[model samples]
Target chain A: AQTVTQSQPEMSVQEAETVTLSCTYDTSESNYYLFWYKQPPSRQMILVIRQEAYKQQNATENRFSVNFQKAAKSFSLKISDSQLGDTAMYFCAFSASGTYKYIFGTGTRLKVLA
Target chain B: DTAVSQTPKYLVTQMGNDKSIKCEQNLGHDTMYWYKQDSKKFLKIMFSYNNKELIINETVPNRFSPKSPDKAHLNLHINSLELGDSAVYFCASSPRGGANVLTFGAGSRLTVL
Candidate 1:
């Protein structure tokens, strides 16, 4: 019954610049987890960052961070100082607390141009 | 050492053929999942196993079957493969009480000719 949406099909950013990929989800659960995963050319899905709905503070992992607006039901990823290696397909995912299932959004193909 | 590994990284076969993709996780987690990434880059959960017990089974075709012999192994078997079955299948695992931080394996790309 939960769904995630990534409106941007593709995105591009120049090296050393910043780009933000938008994501929105619909869930009735009050406690949940949100994640951002990156799949490189090798097709290995790597966890980028994660945020808990109960945590008011957003999550940050080095150059990658999330702007989680719980009330707005929006979780966007911002990649700062982007590098060519950051080019990959990024996915937004949601999982309810105490559940093993995850609902993923349609990926956003990101290209970090040098 | 690979945390999660799936065999047959690339499987190309003719339609109506049967194939199996093996998955093993060394993380000792209680939960494992099979996700399908279609050509449109959409990832959907197909099945999940917790300690060799079926947990989540999506509305996938009956041709797709999943077997979990143990907590660390989950294998997927597809019968009468169709052209639409051509997609990347990913195996992932995560700790039961954790935040659902999935550690995924290198996907197995299935191409049906």
Candidate 2:
């Protein structure tokens, strides 16, 4: 079974600053995908960024980027120029190349102070 | 247009009662899923359907039943709800069977008193 782990239970960042949320996973499958999702107080799950295991280059979306180390099985999300609206519960998820199930991490609550 | 939508954004029901959460997706996607977010904020997959076919059924209890009327709608029904069943349920959709990016709906908060 594949499991995603988010070490940081909580994180805080000032407005316009940068913060990184650490994530690691245990999986034997080589073909898979990783994703970072944010859930605000509204409780809507939003996709922040995603990385494919086969791709050596990391994935970046606007102010969000992921440092994906396949060998280390680590996928970290970095949020730059953080804003108050960025405060949310962030989760790391994993899914095999042809699997319909997605395993999610425990989640990290991020607070962006103004 | 809303890609994925769930009805009764907030559900408050008594214990042992039966309740249902409805979900629909207009993205014309072939796959849909249900996930539960516990009070501790741990998200876990409960069920997945592809074109009205059951694909993945996690370790969820038998009291929880998922019904897919069509390719675009997947509904979750809970029989004899318990306090432990209180959590936020999210419905999501993907274009294909697997490994595709998911589009999630604003969750339905279910509280079993």
TM-score of chain A of each: 0.99, 0.99
lDDT of 2 at A97: 89
Best by lDDT: 1
The segments of candidate 2 whose C-alpha lies over 4 angstroms from its true place after superposition are: none
lDDT of 1 by residue, B15-111 (tens): 9999999999999899999999999888999999889999899999999999999999999999999999999999999987337799999999999
- What residue pairs are clashing in model 2? none
lDDT of 2 by residue, B9-72 (tens): 9999999999999999999999999999999998889999999999999899999999999999
Q: How far out, in Å, is residue A48 in model 2?
A: 0.6
Worst 10 residues of 1 chain A by lDDT: A95-104
Q: What TM-score does model 1 achieve against the real structure?
A: 0.98
Local distance difference test, each candidate: 0.95, 0.94
TM-scores of the models, in the given order? 0.98, 0.98
